[model samples]
Target: MEKQLRKQVTALALYQIIGGILGILLTLWVMFRGELVLTQQVLRFSLFAAALFMFSILCGRMLFRNPPRGLVLSLLHQVLQVVYFTFGEYGFQYVAGLRIGFGFDMVGSWTFKFRVALSSFQFDFGNATGQKFIGINLVALFLIFWIERLLEQGKR
Candidate 1:
């Protein structure tokens, strides 16, 4: 109902969509490539992506409950950047894990634990994965928004 709440919901939805896409892509990559073991590297990245998705949802919750569009959007951007970094750190781990015959469930849980450990330690900083996601998402979001704008303008 409220604008802030609406925006938060939208952000959460976007985060989930991105996360699902990442998971699917990782799975497909593993299936096609084929490997021996799901390494710690793969586990780590997958976990980070999962954490970032959850963090995005959490950020949305905070954003919607508060006000000021700029601030809320900024918060989203900051969190998204962090998510990207985290995904990089663990992305390879997830892929590696899959290569070793570990199911998504196990890999996903491993990621969840990794997030818990990070949160527990209160160590939140940018990593290589974050940089990767920031760049990719920037371009990807632009394309997505551009397409949406075109459709809207067409309707008008």
Candidate 2:
């Protein structure tokens, strides 16, 4: 792997690890605090969140150990965040939505960082029930692209 590619992988790995830790912490806080009753829906959501965070940490570890697999996992993870997915009290639906060319996201009370920009940070808080979230996460998309390009170059 090239120096540039190595650095990007390291950065992504760190990001994933840190984000996973923070998410776990936040989910715990939300659960313990009793902000919402522990219903099947909420419990399911919490379990899913925890599982996803753990998966992210695993992806980060994989990235550090194996770039090819790591890059693919990271790409899948980012694609998941971009894809249209929703879990609500009424029911859970994970279909129908794709944002290409630009970035935008709409989420409810469950708040998380919607990464935007290649080398920058944008943070938004959630407070409204019916909120329309708009964000840009070109960073994840571009980083995976650049990493793949670098890997291809290295192969040649």
Candidate 3:
């Protein structure tokens, strides 16, 4: 049980690092492209998001020497992530009538189907930037999985 827990914690840390790196790269990409299509608030928030994820990576790296220490540190990381995601979604939905694109569409698809007269319909942004973000996230998650596999192998 202890060994398994350690592995899980390590995997979580690896995922955090990979995710943070992707976010940072996205921010840099936006910076170089010289686009002001989004509000300044949005850009600042994106930087905050990247920093938040990096903090998780730092926490994991700092605590890895002791299993118990790492477990405690990781729990704090989890709590911060949960709080951030919850508040972030709430704020986005309150301001933009949506929390992450496709959210409304996904909910509508699940709750009601084939409704031609539903009074409201969700349309995807279908923007190139959004597609780029999706691609980056996908790659980051793949890297996280690869890192987990390597860590698992090392454990054995």
Candidate 4:
């Protein structure tokens, strides 16, 4: 169990570090392209991603210390991720409107207006392709919980 916990923590930390570096590079590219407006958006999104990554790391640490409590924290983290992505996508489609060129049809004017009112975080939700992306994340969370349970059983 301790070994598994250590592995999970290391993996998670590495994931966050790599993601943060990539996000910084992408933001810098946008800035260099002379797209100040897009640059600002990207910067905001990057900051939000950083914050989320930090939260995940904190949760990972807590999970490492206590499996049951960690499982609950992980569940909450997944739920928060879903809400964040949903609203973030909605913001891009509705709030930013056609200005962002997300390569997809709008979700209608009324829905757009409603979403704009909800939040200001914008992200390309894969141009409204489907719920597959979110589904995969949820599934991964479930699998993590299952694996933790199995590991706990082995310890017992």
Candidate 5:
């Protein structure tokens, strides 16, 4: 890699690692923050999510090695962030069609990096019910793809 790209990847690695840590910490806080009691099922799910975050942190560290394997793992980390599910809280009648939205939620406040969207564009920083969403972490994806592109350019 070129010097400039090296610096960029280094920065991105740091960001990814920090994001993983933040994701874990935030999930923990949210898990126990409210007065609502956690069911056994929810606790199990939270534990699983924590494990995934920990793995993501490991993937971020691999980016520091800058090996071919590192690139693969880093990309996998980003892909793992992608999620698929329906809110199913309420039906959308105003759009009258399937309204798939791309947006950012609370930045791993309740969940980890998720990249699941369809056709709409939006940014959600608040608590919205039926129409809102927890979409992809475009930042993470953009950084990884940028690094890949820079690496290819360096190869040239």
Candidate 6:
């Protein structure tokens, strides 16, 4: 059980680390391409990525000291992902519509049109392009959860 918990924590840590590296790289790339200015959005995303990396390390340490039950950790991860997706960089209204495809606007639209509109969020990122960082992180979380489930089943 401790090994499994450690594996889960490691998965989260990888997510954070990868996100941070990618965020930094993209920011630098944009700066080089444009006026070499660091906008507030870019700075916010960079800081958020750094914070996530730190949080991941802290969670790993805490798990080593006192491991949580698998279900509890899973629930906590899910809740955190939900909060991040809803209120993080991309903003609630946008990501929710992209993820669930059940927003108010979707109700009256044709199925195909709704799908297109929902998928558009991938490119739109609403008013803030930097919000794409959160959206990508959300996708990474989904993949991590799926991978974790697979690993758990393998153990069983």
**Ranking, lDDT, top scorer first:** 2, 5, 4, 3, 6, 1
**Which lDDT values do the candidates have, in the order given?**
0.37, 0.57, 0.41, 0.43, 0.52, 0.41
- Residue 24, candidate 3: alpha-carbon lDDT: 60
Per-residue lDDT of candidate 4, residues 3-91 (tens digit): 76656644544443443344444445655677566556566675765555455555556655675565566556544433223332343
For model 1, residues 1-156, the per-residue Cα lDDT tens digits are: 455445545564454345445544554465347673666655664466556545534444443454244234434434333322234344322210111111122323432122211111012334443422211223334433543443344344
Off by more than 4 A, model 1:
1-36, 67-156
TM-scores of all predicted structures: 0.32, 0.64, 0.44, 0.41, 0.61, 0.37
RMSD of each: 14.2, 7.9, 11.5, 9.9, 10.4, 8.3
Candidate 2: TM-score? 0.64
- For candidate 6, what is the TM-score? 0.37
Query: What's the CA error at residue 16 for candidate 1, in Å?
Result: 6.6
- Tell me the lDDT of candidate 2: 0.57
Better of 3 and 5 by TM-score: 5
Clashing pairs in 4: none
Q: Best TM-score goes to which candidate? A: 2
The Cα error of candidate 2 at residue 11, in Å, is 0.8
Among all candidates shown, the one with the greatest lDDT = 2
Candidate 5 lDDT score relative to the true structure: 0.52
RMSD, candidate 4, Å: 9.9
Q: lDDT tens string, model 5, 26-116?
A: 6677778896479775676567666666766676688677545566676666554433233424211111012232443343355444333
Per residue, candidate 2 scores C-alpha lDDT tens digits across 40-123 of 766777787777777777878898998888877876766545423322222221111122324233463535544322111112
